[model samples]
Target: MEDEAPVIYGLEFQARALAAQAGETDQIRFIVGTQSLRQENQVHHIDFDDENNVINKNVFMHREGEMWHISASTVDKSLLTTCYNKTSESKAEMRAALWRLPGDFDDVQSEDQSSHQSLSLVCHLDATDYGDMKSVMWHPTGDNSNVVGLADNHIVVWDIDTSGNSAQMTSSAGLESKGQPKLTCSSWDPHHNCVQIATANDTFIRGWDLRTMQQTYVIENAHGQLVRDVDFNPNKQYYIVSCGDDCKVKFWDIRNVGEPLKVLSDHSHWVWSVRYNRFHDQLVLSSSSDSRVILNNIVSLSSEPYGNLIENDEDDDDDADDRESREASPPQDGVIATYEEHEDSVYTVDWSTADPWVFASLSYDGRLVINRVPRAEKYKILL
Candidate 1:
């Protein structure tokens, strides 16, 4: 007989973007949004163990604004918090703040067991230049000195290290098509040597090389409807994945931008976000407006051995048949799991960088759920 595998635990919250600490696998953080009646928003940090027990919990930030987007710094374990105050029907102000863990912070226990310390505000910038900020991201490399923000019709880059008082917007890029709808989402390309960004606007995904301050590549009508989110594969340089209002996920190779490498249509409603598993190259997760989170296995669909047909000189007719067979083969995406716990539309889903099995999902109804991938090996042993 074999012992039972450990059962994973989940914690729920009222938040938007849930980010795991850079080097700490057990630490997770997120920010709550302001309610329509002007209730205050907050940032939360939680520490959990392998068995899903909550070790420590703290409120990192408490303020009077709505957090539109939040990103955790990969290099320094800090957080980039972006928020806005809607003053009137058509007037709003946006701000970005950097928060860091205090030096005397303890993962074990504090002298005051009843009190928890808040995260220290390193610096913050308030600007009226960019209104209605939609997304924010930290540069993957360069010691995380650079941050990017996307707003109505422009993108702004900030230099946190060089600026003495607070992070300053160093440069700005305006959308080529000015009158179109504001940018929907933006992602930093992890594999590019320099700073390269991919942004979704309406039905197109545009790639920008920040080094040259130019648009490098653009995919026209990347989706049937408005593109919601775009993410690049961390393992492969030119590979990208995007989700859109059409309830479809599309994959693209930047080198060949004419068509998507594959299109995955599984979600029944608008797919809001898509993420690639950091540890497993084959796994991708998406959250949709249908109140479900889906896990997809795309290794067979994207790998060359399964997607491409072999050619042989011995049989010309066989080679032609093989080509036809390859063209007729459907996408090899398999839905391994579906999570339907959230009562509202799930807006965000993120995978933990340190833990392979742990992930988090958040919904518009102020519900957040932490989940673990079910493993059969943990439950049974083969004899």
Candidate 2:
């Protein structure tokens, strides 16, 4: 396969949030929300077509408020969640809610193209009157019925009844200390069948076991500064990756958080996000305020470094060639690429659900750049 140029798309408004659409493999789709308090905010649906090397888009109006975050639902292809800024009693407040797309979204387009359809309302998530809603995370598994909302000093799990278009809080835990330290970020534990969650509170990484609504583990000072994002290793049971303002991306085996399994100081500024490839845990991505996206191939720490190997008892020659090919590719344990396509701070980077080699990054300036792994690197392991 030949290497191709990275595809770039710009939005009309500035943005900081993006999420790859889930449960679909036909098209490379991403959902982005705009942040503009002065004008009407919008939700952008971007589709990247690899065969033609082009992008297709659809825009929907979000009349509620300025958007801060967006999350696509895995169980329902048409449903999504957002955390938005709104004016409540002459004060700015953030809230979370579920919105759905029209059934004919794929085929529907206006004649003028200027008039856009508004997102259908699914439900409004319940939150404290004063706490600022940071993000609404869907379950780690395919089930979207249960969602956890992280806000100032609190983490709440909600039971969403999409059929009735309503949400009810099931359980919640508040951080109590000398000063109520606000929660920063969190990820649902996929290893525990989504019964536990790992949250970043300031510099601390705390694991919450939802079965008993109790704290299971706490990693004090996971980072020197505020933790920005945490993601679970999809293939590994207890492994997680975290990044923070310290400009370090640390991988941990949640069972023992005393020391990180590996630490990478690749970004010069604050590391805003760290993600593990859903299929290949060794492939990691980190975005930062330095306006760069770093892709790392972490081999030894991954569950499988050389892909699945089947020992052959009959063909000695075939096995030897296989071994040589694996050796030649040698697991690259360090940074592979630093993408500086965006001039503004990159808050999020996500791998495409449709294509493993393809991923996208969103900057604060509303620029979306979709890029792929170098073909030479992609063929190293395959050949």
Candidate 3:
């Protein structure tokens, strides 16, 4: 049989948020960020075929407010929401509300009610407002009722009740810095009993223990410039990765806060986002200001024996040979593939939670590309 061709698609409005629904392989959703002369900001749902062709799409407009960040629940695939920071001459408030999915798939409707019934507000917050909200994320575990939002220099946690009718502030923590850098990103550690949260601020990557509400660790000078994104390895407890304005992607072991385990400098411009494949821990995806998306194999560096050297041979000559063996090995965290299909700066790249080989990238130029990692390269495993 002939090889299947790759599938590609583009959007007219910049995508501010791109999320692949959990347990879904053929459909993904995004929010249009930039308002155009002809088109207003809207939420879009798109479906693709096996060949990667766009098959279906649904678009809806949010007339009440503008959205800055969006997050979907993993436990309940039907729930997706956006956070808005409304600033005006009189007051500045931040709130999060659900996006009513078009059609009969609405989760809010009762069994006896029709889908056309008016949608109700899911969450409203007035006491814990921030100046400029940057990012928001739903907790990976639990019932997905908890959410964390990054604004200014503080991180605020909120718990949504089962009904989604009300949201309550659970806790808030301030970033430890002499001069507060804009909090750019935040992520939850996926491992069990890992109450750790990671945040990227300016040139630093800091970790916090939510259990005690204390700063657990800090890696200073994490990036040459402001760090734009950070993600923890879902399968590994102590591993994390970050990207920033320095145009470099760096990996770190959270247990050792001194230095990055590996630095993958492939992008020629600012790197905006880095995400690890939830299933394939060794694979990472990154998008850059150079208008390109790159996939990397992180298995090599992750397999290295760091701080756990076994000294079977006690002779000095044997020890020297062992050191040379370690030094001669080629660095593992290298760029495996690059996708330069975006016309503008690629802002976000998200891997499908259901399929390890399939991933998506969204750019500031309003292009969204769904791609599958090459089959030939997929079988290579680190021995």
**Candidate 1 local lDDT, residue 309:** 35
**Per-structure clash totals for the candidates:** 0, 0, 0
**lDDT by residue (tens digit), candidate 1, 168-286:** 77888888784757899998998857479999999989999887668999999999999999888887778889999999999899989999888888899999999987766567889
User: Per-prediction TM-score, please?
Assistant: 0.81, 0.94, 0.81
Tens digits of per-residue lDDT, candidate 2, 13-79, equal 9998899987556778989999987889999888898989898888889988888888988767788
Indicate the residue-level lDDT of 341 in model 2.
Answer: 94
**Model 1, stretches more than 4 Å misplaced?**
1-14, 23-37, 52-56, 86-90, 102-119, 142-144, 162-165, 301-332, 376-383
**What RMSD, rounded to one decimal, does every model reach?**
6.6, 2.2, 6.6
Candidate 1 overall lDDT versus native: 0.69
* Candidate 2 similarity to native, TM-score: 0.94
Off by over 4 Å in 3: 1-4, 23-39, 85-95, 100-120, 125-128, 162-164, 302-333, 381-383
lDDT of 3 at 365: 66
As for lDDT, the candidate ahead, 2 or 3, is 2
Model number with the top TM-score: 2
lDDT of the structure predicted as candidate 2: 0.86
